[model samples]
Target: MKKAFKYRIYPNKAQQALLQVTFGCCRFVYNKTLDIRKKAYETDKTKLSKFDLIKKITPLKEEFPWLRDVPHVCLPQAVYNMDAAYQNFFKSGKGYPKFKSKHRSRKSCKFPSSHCAVLQDTSHLKLSKLGLVKYKKDREFAGVLRHIVVTQESDGRYYASCLVETGADAPEPQPVEASTTVGIDLGLKDFIVTSDGRKISNPRFYATIDRRLACLQKHEAKKTKGSKRRARIRLKINKLYVKKRNLIKNYIYYVAKTLLRESQTLVMEDLNIVGMVKNHSLAKSIQNICWGELRRVLEYKSQWSGHNLIFIDRWAPSTKTCSHCGFHNSTLTLSDRSWVCPGCGTHHDRDINAALNIKRMGLASLLPAVSGFDGRGEVGYGLDEASICTV
Candidate 1:
């Protein structure tokens, strides 16, 4: 397995200057190589190979002497990244590569395994060009170092992401008890409502900072471009944004961890977040909720922790169906928080009822394809018993 561990690093003034140059050189190489690839494909209907772009580096450095000031390894890494971006675009049908801006783009550079080394227990990293820089190593990993990416965020904080190849393979999930199964209903009002009638209140992380963020943006807009005042305000805005992101990230991690710990089998609605965000009135609220990110966190964590994570169909009428008597209420609107089921005559809490329905559906889907089999059996054909933990 491959994993990345990131840590905050504090570089001296001279190192910062060198890093800035390295960032610029890397960005320049990426953009230049992208341009070369585009022109090559357009003219000859052929893509520029990584080796072809790499061969140009020697001449490029000789022509532009300043490129020699940064680490020689960075240029090749940039070209490799460009090749990867192009490959990803072709493979995934993603958008075409775009040129990176020095001012607006992310400042980052990758150092290959041989180019960088970490000092054990010294809390320092040594690079080919950049000398030993102090970093806060919260935890250490036992693995072969693959690569390191040094990035400067908008908040003016520098971070080092160390990628390592851990020799351990993923563990297989154990069988789960039916009593520990849970279903979660995500919402703007309450972050998560469980099938067991537990409601986790939504902590609007962005809402808390929205006013200050808006004020900063408003002031930043009024400031003249290229002025020091604009730069100062921009930094302030970025710091706030980073804070907001951190808060939400920490909250989501806590929620996911807690849920996974409590539930052996977890089920959630497969929400269409992109389509949901199209509603202008609820866009801000939906964005702040960050349902997609939470789901993503749950997905990977579940695999590692040996938990079952299931996602029900988005179009399922979880809200309309009664958990008690399986009554379908067609006229149930979004505004109706609580409703009495016509067929069941049971009052249902909208979110909780939906959660229950989702749980039932997920468990049903896990039922054996052919009857007379012992235990839960295989979760339908094409899905093996061992792979049911995967989302």
Candidate 2:
């Protein structure tokens, strides 16, 4: 098994400057290569591969001879990544590659320069360009380093992620006795309301910290673009975003672990959250809950613990399907939070009913009552077009 451990690397001022220069150079090369490919298609049908592009890099070496000694892997990795981008485009059949937007800054670069130091046992980790950087977090890792990826964040944080091969320490679990299976209904009002009368409210960390973030953004806007003041403001905002993300990730891990520890089987309604976020009123709240990420954690955890994870179909009528009596009320709408079941005298909480129906569907899936989704094949992406069949 491979595990990743992240630590804050404390690079000195000089090291930070050098690292930034290297990062800037890498970004320049990546953008240049994309331009080259774009021009190649525009000029002629001839294509340019990494090998063809390496010759052009020689001119770059004359301009920055220091880069020539930087190491082979670092530069080639960028070219290979560009190739991979085209590969994925064809695989997904999601139309032609669109030019990356300035506002939509979602990409990153890697440096595999041999000089890029591995996480070693010295007082600090030394990189070729960055020099020795200290850390407070435990680097006493117990795994062999398999691969390393050095990422330059858009906000200018340098992170070295190591893929390490570690021996599994999983305990041979005792056979679980009779335990309850559960279905989860993720919502905006409540973070999650389960079939078993359990409901957790939305923490809304982003909403809580919105004022601070807005202030930071305003401060950033006031600063001259590319000035030191702008960089400093951007860095502060990046840390806040990172902090919120970490908190959310930790909370999700806790919930998923707790659920896995107690349950023998976990059932969830297959929701295309990407699609659900289209409604302007609920989009912000939905993004805050990060329901999709929560489900992902539950999936891997349940799989590791030898428990079943079932994803009821999107069209399963979980919300409208009555648990007390097997009645499918097709007329149930979003506005009705409470319902009087015509089939049986039962008061059903909207979320709870959905959860129970999910549980029933999960149970039914285990049997061969209907064509059970094998969780294989292409899954949903985009608005409600989900990739969660195997969820």
Candidate 3:
């Protein structure tokens, strides 16, 4: 198993300067290699592998002597990272490699284990070029260090994320049962509504700070660009953004941890968040809810905890269909929060109904294949049988 531990690092002025140079060098290497690979493929349909790109770094250093000033190991790692991006592009048919911008792109660089180490005191970290830098180690971690990535955030805070191999086998997933299973419907009104009838209210972290952030931005806009005042205001705005993100992250972690601790098989909708955010009216709210981030956290944590995480088809009519009587309510509008099922006279809460349907859909996927099991049945197609099997 592999785990990552992140800690804030305080680098001296000289170390910070070197870190900035290392970040620039790494970005330059990545963008230059990407350009080379793109042109090679476009002109002659040639492919450049990781090693091939690494071989070019030597000549690149000869051409640009400043590249030699940063740690040598980081340069090759940059090529490796670019190669990975290209490979992912080819595999996914999306996310083509793009040039990293000095201002917009993330300021980060990777260092191999040979060039990085955590000191015995655990309060200091040693890197090849940058000597021992002090860091706040919040928790103890035991593992063989694989690598470390140093990142400088928008607010000028620096952190180190250390990846380590724990050398432990992951627990096997437990069997799914109705009593132990749960379904989650993520929403803006509420953070989540579970099949078990639990509703966790959305904290609306962004909304809480929206007015203040807007005020800060307005003040920042009044300042002249490239001026000290503008820079100070910009830093303040960035810090606020960081605070909002941290709040949301911590809340989601708590929610995910609670769910995984209680449920054996967790089911959720595979929402198309990219498409959902297209609605101008809901874009800001949707982004603030961080549905995608919550799902991502649930996925990895479930795997780590040996729990089953299930995502039903994105097209599944969890919202429109009646969970009680298996009736398809095609007329159910987005504004309809509560609806009475015409088929069975059952009253349903929209989110809870959707959650139940999601749970049923997930359990249906685990059913043994049979002649009538088409796998595309409606939300409550075989609810009775599933309930029986789960019991």
Distance from true position, residue 384, model 1, in Å? 22
* Consecutive 10-residue window with the lowest summed lDDT within model 3: 382-391
What is the C-alpha lDDT profile of model 2 across 202-291, one tens digit per residue? Answer: 656666566798899999999898899888888888888876777778888877887777777778877676565564764454444567
Q: Backbone clashes per model, in order?
A: 0, 9, 0
Candidate 1: tens digits of C-alpha lDDT, residues 270-385: 87765665767644555545778899899888887778888878777778877776666899888999999787577889999888777766765666531332233123223223
Would you list the clashing residue pairs of candidate 1? none
Q: What is the C-alpha RMSD of each candidate to the true structure, in Å?
A: 4.5, 6.7, 3.9
* Residue 214 shift from truth in candidate 1, angstroms: 1.8
Per-residue lDDT of 37 in model 1: 79
Cα lDDT for residue 226, model 2? 88
Candidate that scores best on lDDT: 3
Residue-wise C-alpha lDDT for candidate 3, range 99-126, written one tens digit per residue: 9999999999999999999884758999
> Which residue ranges in model 3 land beyond 4 Å of their true spot?
120-122, 282-289, 368-391
Clashing pairs in 3: none
Q: Identify the leading candidate in terms of TM-score.
A: 3
Question: Which scores greater on TM-score, model 2 or model 3?
Answer: 3
Q: Give the better candidate number (1 or 3) by TM-score.
A: 3
